[model samples]
Structure formats: structure tokens, C-alpha cells
Target chain A: MNALIIEKTEDSPGVKFDPATAQLSLSGESRPENAGKFYNPLLEWITQFESILFWRKEQKMDQKPLVFAFRLDYFNSTSAKYIMDIILTLNKLADKGYPIRVEWYYDERDEDMLDAGKEFAEMVQIKFDFLPN
Target chain B: MRHFNNPVIKIGAHETGKPYFSHTKHQHLHFSQNIMQDNNSLNAYEVHKFMSKMDILVAFTGHFDHQMITILLKNIRGKLKTTSPEMAIEQKVYCILVECVENVSKYSSGNEDSSRNGMFMLCKSDTKYTVITGNPMLNKDIPSLKAKLENVSKMSREELKQLYRQQIMSERETENNAGLGIIDIALKSGNQFHYNFKPLTETTSFYHFQTEIEINS
Candidate 1:
């Protein structure tokens, strides 16, 4: 699968989802003027990844533990909804026998960010490894 | 220096063209007139002093857009980082500021075109920080807005979080009005907020929204 790499902007986050390495990450602030325009494509990519995972299963290819890292410093409410969508999508992927792990990195001083991660974790019923940066 | 024939002293303009005034019957017209004469040129020092007295750390009035909001957030981030003792409080304040200003840009009546007129101010007291925002909104939207505000204000923290999650997941939520932003604000500030809608006309009203966060320092 091709990697999805998007450079961060003043109001959007940097995204790098490498299928070969099985490491996906989003970092920086997210307060895009149009949250859907920025996030919908990423959600579609994840959905495509799910289809690829199914094809790999038919070929009996060993699945790697995919890690999705979220290192966001700040995100608006609208962006938060999209993040939740991303995680819930990942949760569905996990339910389909994909080995997925979510790593949530937040500033040690930003308890709100940490709490946001916790809320996502609880809402999706996923174990997120919270790391303070 | 255009004079009006009605003898009504124009203190300012409301909604751009409507004159708001002090009538000559109030007996303070002379003092107001004196200030108006001096107001031909604003005294920057006096304005600064007034802001300082009001404990206003930041204030802006006029048009707002995504680009302008980004610039304001950059400056606000720097200011909060320096003055706020804890990063948690700074992050909350910053988040709340973004919501307030973004709402201004998105929902202000003037935003029907490209012009988004609003007012924003961040003031600090000994124990809490207050954010104030005002914008003109269509009067027809007031009842629903008032109901939303009242409903959220009455909710508990946990209930607000639940509603936030539900709203985010609901398919009915739209790009422009998910109604999650206010829920987020209420959750962050613990519902320590107030809102008012003052009728500007039969078709429009000026909305004032203020939220407060206690300084945990």
C-alpha cells in the first residue's frame, strides 16, 4: 500500500502513514477552517487500509502490529470529532483481526491533552499507551 | 464634525448606522460633548490605561477570519505561556479562546458575506480568567441558541462529556454546526459561562458570550 504523507500547515497537522513500516502518526495543531476537507481523505485511506488487510489475510501474509501515534499539541472541537472518528475506525479495524496499537503522546504539562486521549480510549474501549513528552 | 438637528448627542453607533445617544435632558451632554471634541484624536495612553485598569490582557474588535485567528492564537499562546504558571490552565484558556473566536468568525451575522464583525477580550483577575465575545446574530436563531445554552448550563460535567461524545458520533452533525463546540466549552470551563442576546432589530440581535476559568495556581 502506498504511504500517505501530508505536511503540516498553520492550521493542520502533519500525517505520515507508512504501510511498510506499519507505523502511522499525526502530529501538530489541528484547527482547520474546514475539518472535513482535511480529515475525510484520511478516513478514506484508513478504510482502504482495512480492505488491504483483508487481501493480505487471503495470501496468508503475517500481520505486523500496526501502531498509530497521536502527538497533537492542540486541536479544536471540530478536529476532536474527526480524531474520534479516526480512532473508532481503527477500533473497527482491530475488531477485524488487525493487530493495532494506539500510542498517545502528550506534553507532560498538558493534562487536558492527556485527558482527551483517555476519553478517546474509554469511548473506543481501546488500551492506549499514554506517554508524556 | 457633522451636526445633527435633533440636539441628541451621539455617544456611538449601534449596528453601524443607528445612532445611540445621550439626550440633552440627562444634563451630561456638555461633558459628553467635551469628550467627543477630544475624541477626534484618540489618546493611546488613556486607552492603554483603561485596558490595564480593566485587567484586559488582550482585546480586539472588528473583522475575524481563519487567518486572523491564527495570528491571534500565536500571540495569545505566547502571552499565556509567559503569564500562566501552569501549562494546563494555559492550554484550557487557549482552547477556550479558539472556540470563542472561531464561533465569531463562523456564525456572526456579518459572515453572510466575507465580513465577520465581532469583539473579543481576555481579562484576568486575581483568581480567574474571563473570555468575552460579542457578535451580531440573526434574531430568529436566538430561541434555539438560548435553549441550547440553558440546557448545557444545567448539565453535569459527566453528562456534558457524554453529550459531546454522542454529538461527535451522530451522523446529523454538520461541518458548520455540529453543536459540539459549545459542549466542549462548557466541559472545559465547568459550565462557568453566561450568554445574552440583545435585540438589534426584528431580524438581528447582538450576542454576548462570556466564559470564566479559575486560575489553579
Candidate 2:
């Protein structure tokens, strides 16, 4: 599958999803004026990749485990909802037995970010590796 | 503390000679020169002292626009790093400020006759920081804004999470940030949302909102 990459901006986060490398990640701050416009493409790309991902796994051709890393220092609540959506989609794929794991990184000093990641970890079905930076 | 209905113009020492008030034909005086000259009592140094006593860190009042938002956020981020000891508290404060500013900017009527004017301030009180924002908006937007604020304010932590999830999954087009900005502020501030609306004119009103976040020591 083709990789989907979104460059970083002052008001948005950078997104990279490469099925080839089994790497999916989002980093930086996310406080966009219009969350829908910014996150819509990211969601659509993930959905497209999900279909191909499941189909590839069905063919018994699973190469490497997928890694989803979230390294956001600051994301408004609206952006948090979008992040949850991404996680939910990924968890559904994980449920299908496609090897996947989520890695959440936060600064050791940033308790709110850490708590947010932990909260999402508890709310979702998949377990997350909370890495403190 | 003083609320104003009409546009209050304060002429600085530099613009002293120019007519502060404008009239097409008649230059009839309304308030009087005595009140106009009373601004000599309003000293910038005294105002700074008062603001300092209240630990006022950031304050701005003007038109709300995209460029202004960016500049304000950048200034807040820089200021918070020095004032706040913990990164977590700084981040939370920044988040709340962003929401407040965005909310004010997003819903502002921006009418041609009377453009949307806004005021934003951040003050420190003991172990908490308060964000206060006010803007001129159409009176019609009040009901929906009130309903959303009341709903979020009433929700428990768990309920708020569920609502957030449902809203995102439904792909609803919100007024701003999918109407999730206010909810996010409430949740982060531990449900500290105080809002009021003052009638400014027949169709316009001034909306004031304040939220407090506990400074993590």
C-alpha cells in the first residue's frame, strides 16, 4: 500500500502511515481552527489502509508487526476525539489478528499528556506502551 | 469591572490634538470635556501595578482573527514556560486558552457596521490560573452556546469521554472544532466554566466566559 504522509504545520500535527514499513505515527502540536478539515484526510487514509491491511493479513503474508506511535505534546480536546477515532480503527484491525501495537510517548514532565494517553489506553480495547520522554 | 455598551475611545497623549469623536456635520458634545480629560487619572503604571497584583500574565482586546490567534498562542506558550514550573500545567493552561480564544473568534458575528471585538486575559490566583474571554456575538447564538456549555458542565468524566467519542464517530460538522473545544476546556479545567451574556443592543450581546485550571505545583 502507498504511504500517506502529512507535513507538520504550526497549527497541525505531522502524520505518517507506511504499510510498507509497518509504521504509523503522529507527532507535534494539534490545535487546528477546523479539526474536521485537518483530520478528515488522515481518517480516510487510515480506512483505505485498513482494508488493504486486513486483506494482506488474510493472505498469510503478514510481514512485520505494525507500530502506531503518538508523540503529541499538546492537542486540544477536539483533536483528542480524532486521535481516539484513529485508535478505535486500529484496534478493530488488531482484533482481526493483524499484528499491531500502539506506542504513546510523552515528556516525563508533562503529566496531562501522559494522563491523556493513559486514559485513551484504558478506554480502548488495545493496550498501549506508554513511553516517557 | 466597568462594562461598556458603546465603543469607548481613549485618546493617548500622542493623539491629543485630533478629535477623538467623529461627526459628519454637527460636533455636538455628548459626555463633556471634563470626563474626556479625566483619563489623566488613568495611569499606565498604576494599571500595571493593579494587573501585577492580580498576577495578570496575558491580556489583549481587539479584533479576533487567524493571525491574531497565532500570535497570541505563541506569546502564551513563551510566557507559560517561564511562569509555570511544570510542563503539564503549562500545557493544560495553553489548551484552555486556545479553546477560549478559538471560541471567541469562531462565533464572533464580525458584522460590517460593528465588527466583532474581543478581550482575552489570563490571571493567576494562588494555585490556579483563570482564563477570561469576551466577544460581541449575535443574540441568536446564545441559546445554542448555553445549551452546549450546560450539557458539558453537567457531564461526569466518564460521560464526557463517551460524548467526545460519539461526536467524533458521528462525523458531525460542528460550529467550531466540531463543538468539542468548549467540552475539552470544561473537562480539562475540572468543569470550571462560568459564562454570562450582557445585552449590548437589540440584535447583539457581549458574551463573557471564564474557566479556571489548577496550577500543578
Candidate 3:
């Protein structure tokens, strides 16, 4: 699968999904005016990756465990909806017997961010590894 | 107490021999001379004192645009860093302020010039920091907006979480419960927010919204 990478902006988070490393990461702030424009591609990329995973499984290729790290300092509510979508999509991958791990990183001082991650994890019924920075 | 030496309105003759309002670093005023001379004229020094008394850290009233919101957020972030440097409180305050200002910039009806005009303020009391925003909107939106606010205001944290999830999962992104912003604000402020609608004209109303984040010392 081709990697998807986007640089971080003042109002958007950096996105990196590397098939080589089997890791997907989002970092920095996310408060874009049109969040769908920024996140829709990411969701599409994830769906594409799912297709690749299924193909690999069918071909009996090595299935690497995927890791998705979320290191968001801030994201507006509009972005939050997309974030939930991203998580739900990932959870679907997990449901399909694919090994998936979610790492939620937050500043130790930002309890609200931690709480938000917790809330998302609960909503998706996923046990996320909460890492405090 | 900090003293404001500069006057908000400096009354003086312009170089062209016409009386005009002079602005200082404290404030910019374009009121008529008669208004400036009124007993209720705003004095920057007095306003500064009043702000100090009310624990107001930041206030703005003007056209809200994307650039303006970015600048305001940067300024407020700096001010909060200096005035109330607690990380968690700062994040909550910043998040709520972003929502409030962005809400105004996005949803508020255009004024005479079709610009997004609104007012925003941040005040810190002994126990909490308050974010207030006011903007002009169509009167038709009041009933639905009021109901949303009332419903969200009455929800507990758990209920808010559920609503947030439902809104995100809803098929219609732009319809009812599109109040993801309000729910987010309520959740961030620990479920403490107030809102009001003031009738401005037959077709429009002034919307006032306030959110508070507790200062845990």
C-alpha cells in the first residue's frame, strides 16, 4: 500500500500512514474550517489500506500489525466528528481479525485531551493505549 | 492596580483644523464629538479599571473572519499564558473560545457590509474563566437554536457524550443536532454554558452565548 503523508499546518494536523512500517499517525492541532476536505482523504486512505489487508490475507502474505497513533493537542468539534469516523473505521479493521493497536498520546497536563481520547475509545469499544507526554 | 495612562479617546484638532477622534494603544473610538463629550463617554483608564474589577482578560467587537479569528486566538493564547498559566485550564479556555468565535464567524448573519460582525470576551473570576460571544443572526433560527441550547444545557456529561456520538453518526451532517459545536463546548466547560437571544428587528436577533471553565486551584 502506498503511504499517505500530509504536513501539519497551523490549523491542521500532520498525517502519516506508512504501509512499510504499518503505522499511522496524526499529530498537532486540527481546527480547519473545512475539516471534511482535510480528513476525507485520510478516511479513504484507510479504506484503501483495508482492501490491501484483505488482499494480503487472501494471498497468505505476512500480515504486519498496524499501529495508529493520535497525538493531537487540540481539535475543534467539527474535526472531532471526523476523528470518530477514523476510529470507527479502524475498529472495523480490528473486527475483521486484523491485529490493530491504537495509541492515544496527550500532554500530562491536558486532562481534557486525555478524557476526550477516553471518550472516543469508549464509544468505539476499543482499548486504547493512553500515553501521557 | 495597573493604571492606563493613555486615553482611549483623545480630543484634539486635526492637522486639517477639523475635530476628530484620536485613537491610542488603549482603544480606538470613532464616536462623534457630541457623543465623546457626553457624561457617559468611555474613558480608557476607567474602562481599564472596570476590566480589572471584572477580571476581563480580553474583549473584541468587530467583523470576524478567518484571519481575525486566528489573530484573536493567538492574542488570547498569549494573554492566558501570562494571566492564567495553568495548562488544563488554558486548554479548556482556548478550546471554548475557538468554538465561540468560530461559531460566530461561520454562522452569524452578515451585517450591513455582509461581514461577520460579532463580540467576544474572556473574563477570569476567582473560580472560573468565562467566554462570551454575541452576534447577529436571523430571527428564524432562534426557536431551534434555543431548543438545542436548552436541551444540551440540561444533559449530563454522559448524555452529552451520547449525543455527540449520535451527531457524529447521523446521516445528515447539516441538519438537526448539527450542534456538535455546542455539545463540544458544553463538554469542555464541564457542562456549564448559558445562551440568550435578543430581538434586534422583525427579521433578526442578537445571539448571546457564554461558557465557563472552572479554575481548579
**Which candidate achieves the best DockQ against the true structure?**
1
Q: Which predicted model would earn the best lDDT?
A: 1
Stretches of candidate 2 exceeding 4 Å from the true structure: B1-43, B113-116, B154-171, B175-179
Give the local distance difference test score of model 1.
Answer: 0.80
Q: Please, what is the whole-model Cα lDDT of each candidate in the order they appear?
A: 0.80, 0.74, 0.78
Best by TM-score: 1
Pairs that clash in candidate 2: none
Q: Give each model's clash number.
A: 0, 0, 0
Q: Provide the lDDT at B162 for model 2.
A: 79
Higher-TM-score candidate among 1 and 2? 1
DockQ of each: 0.73, 0.58, 0.58
In DockQ, how does model 2 score against the reference complex? Answer: 0.58
Q: Per-residue CA lDDT of candidate 2, range B145-193, in tens?
A: 8899888989998888777656656664653544678767877888877
lDDT of 3 by residue, A62-129 (tens): 98888999999898888888888899999999999888889999999899899889888887755699
Q: What ranking emerges by DockQ with the best candidate at the front?
A: 1, 3, 2
TM-score of candidate 1 relative to the true fold: 0.88
Q: Which runs of model 1 end up more than 4 angstroms from their true locations?
A: B1-41, B110-115
Which of the two, 2 or 3, has more TM-score?
A: 3
